[model samples]
Target: MSLPSTFDPSRALSLARETLDIEAQAVAAMALRLDQRFVAALELVLKSRGRVVVMGMGKSGHIGRKIAATLASTGTPAMFVHPAEASHGDLGMITADDVVLGISNSGESEELTAILPLIKRMGVPLLAITGRGDSTLGRHADVVLDASVEKEACPHNLAPTASTTAQLAMGDALAVALLDARGFKADDFARSHPGGSLGRKLLTHVSDVMRSGDAVPRVPREAGLMDLMREISAKGLGMSAIVDADNRVLGIFTDGDLRRLIERTGSSADLRALSARDVMHPNPRTVRAEALAVEAAGLMEASRITSVLVVDELGRLSGALNSNDLMRAKVI
Candidate 1:
């Protein structure tokens, strides 16, 4: 068969568009079919004391892994198991306290159906996500989630395109439902994803990255101009807090203030007369040590300041943090 040399690219684009439209319609149909079985499935998994054991074959198995990941990340504690490997002893991973989620488009995948009886015998609640409600796996399931699609997006009508997308979306629905049921908070997510930027924003506290003790770049209110500059250089926070004898912050001396002071004073003698109280910016921005790093970043941005003094509940200076610290913590 010779293909037409003058074939338009628009024809191929139209076909692709039609395929997606059909898939979207299929998913919409599935949503309309949702019933009490969905609720029962969620209850079964939510009541399980152990993990959600997800099992499937081929493309369904790939979708199962993603579903399991979403469940685990949202506090459901799920893990995917390949049905092909289950007969070889991986079935030991499932326990009576667990709920088994089996995904099979036809609901009759030989590998998946073969273990249905075993999962039943173990007293594990089996939830099947399938197109055919009368399939062997569905018949054995305690609850069935209808992930049926009218047809595949493949041109030949044989690939797992629309069905897989529906399954993925349904799996997300389950994960999100479970997340809401468990009251999963962003802090809980941060604990699980400590390496990501979201983790830094949620888990990082001001105390974790704040400059403390001698590194806070603090000086007494009576400190001389030269002494304040030395403290700023040694601390490298670009600002020094002027504190009282009790270590309570009274004012702040920043590099910006130093520049303005230099411009106003024509000579070293004029600059020498400037004490901490005389030149310091009084009532500078401050934050609590227990505040979020992101909050610190906000305070810096709103005040147009580079550094903030970290104070305790009693208003005594405890530490300091600059934009650099926020950058290092990935909070900015």
Candidate 2:
């Protein structure tokens, strides 16, 4: 479409801002609508023996799908079902043990209304989220959630704008309430979102990514500068663990230590008299082998360093990791 002849940039921005403000106010008003019925709905879903089956039509259907997904990911078992499909045998998916969450802006979606009787017959609890409490769907529902909005963000007040925003907020409110009641934690969320980056950070342990056994660069505490330098260079870890006879880490000699050593000595000959202990940093940061990879990244970032040693229960070096390893694991 070509630009309108009367188009004005200032007017366009003002209209967009007005739409956002209207939607924001609509969502804010929903907080005040939380009543005894809201708690009743929460308790119904909380005590439900089976999954939450969400249903709706049109834009409300889209919002319903999102609500079901959020609830499922946050520890509540939920699935979205099309109201139109429910009349065509999909209604069989609902059991008496399940809870049905129906969404409709006017509380009069015909597709949804078609199956309301069947859902009621199944003895399933129905939670209606609508703008009208006396609406057919609301009156027949076991519990009603008021999602009415004063007005829509639409200039003509025809589109589902503020009403949909209000519904979405209420859906989020329900999911969060269930989340807290279930005592759902980050680890549980990560499990549900296993394909995402957050799952990698939360579930990937340091031991899974760290280089262990011979892969770790180690030199005896009595080892010379040449041996330490060889170990560091061969491992390409920018550092080498200087350990004692018992394989207990005594110190770490890093590239930074090499720089300081060179600056102090001013010649290669000065390095000949130095052993690993003389130039090694005695206080090195360590992480437990079972720690989350993200936690290791946190330590590395906070210390402004690129790597950390992974220690066993005995405080002996078991593995090693650097920023490169974390990057390879996609944990950073």
Candidate 3:
């Protein structure tokens, strides 16, 4: 692990690339090994009445934690149980209806094997992820997924490199298979990851966060610029919607227009002599109430505007939204 006085860029890059290629090849091979056993494991987890209890030791344990999380977040009930802890009463987490998934490259982790007999006695189904189907863990499993790899990505072939990668890919395949089987949708995913960016993007609709009702600034088209300015100031949107007699949106008057008009006419009082229709920009960029808030952010950024109107299906103003709304919703 000594640092060289001078680094050789090409040699360093080639070593990294070789390691990646080896692991990639390992994952590619594991895909070919998928068979009926994989399907059986998927069904076993899907049909279980209780949660999926994931168990593993060492490197397999790290992979198990992620697998459990993926399963739980993707509409399946699952959790990771450390095999060592299970031996010391953590087995209480395992219910009779739960399905136990044990992972080990050799399929013979002593901590896991020790509890296999008791789990079987409890009548809970056992699923195994292992490199060797004939290993003790695999033999005892109700269903076995072959997660074998040709060789380790380690240069000396002593590390758990390629094998762990295959295990991860296998776990992903299981999660996705069960996810599709359950017909999980984006809303369901958002419920699990409510605090993440993906959740905000999927679950936060324009109507949910928009400033609606009387809070939206609106004035008749015949209203004077002074009236519009007052509405904008009262509503704090920095803009006012000019609606026709039918309450349909006619145009929008923003602070940008006020700034430009003041610069052109050289006086603030002179600009107020005009009507709303005289100074408003017609056909402002708008979004529907049902659209996602992130879409509103996109519209604002792409058009180089700070605010936009929320309109109904028939072009009636339903609400107002601005860059600030997006920022508050964490959609920015």
Top TM-score: which candidate number? Answer: 2
Q: Please give the range of 10 consecutive residues that has the lowest summed lDDT in model 1.
A: 265-274
lDDT of 3 by residue, 1-332 (tens): 98797889897899799989998998888888888888888888878899999999999999999999999999889999999999899999999989999999999899999999999999999999899999999889999988888889788998898888888889899999999999999889998998899999989999988998899999998898888899999999999999987778999999989989888888745666799999989999999999989889988999999999999888999999899989998998
Off by more than 4 A, model 2: none
TM-score for each model? 0.87, 0.97, 0.89
**lDDT (0 to 1) per candidate:** 0.90, 0.92, 0.91
What's the lDDT of the predicted structure labeled candidate 3? 0.91
lDDT-sorted candidate list, best first: 2, 3, 1
Candidate 1 structure, TM-score to reference: 0.87
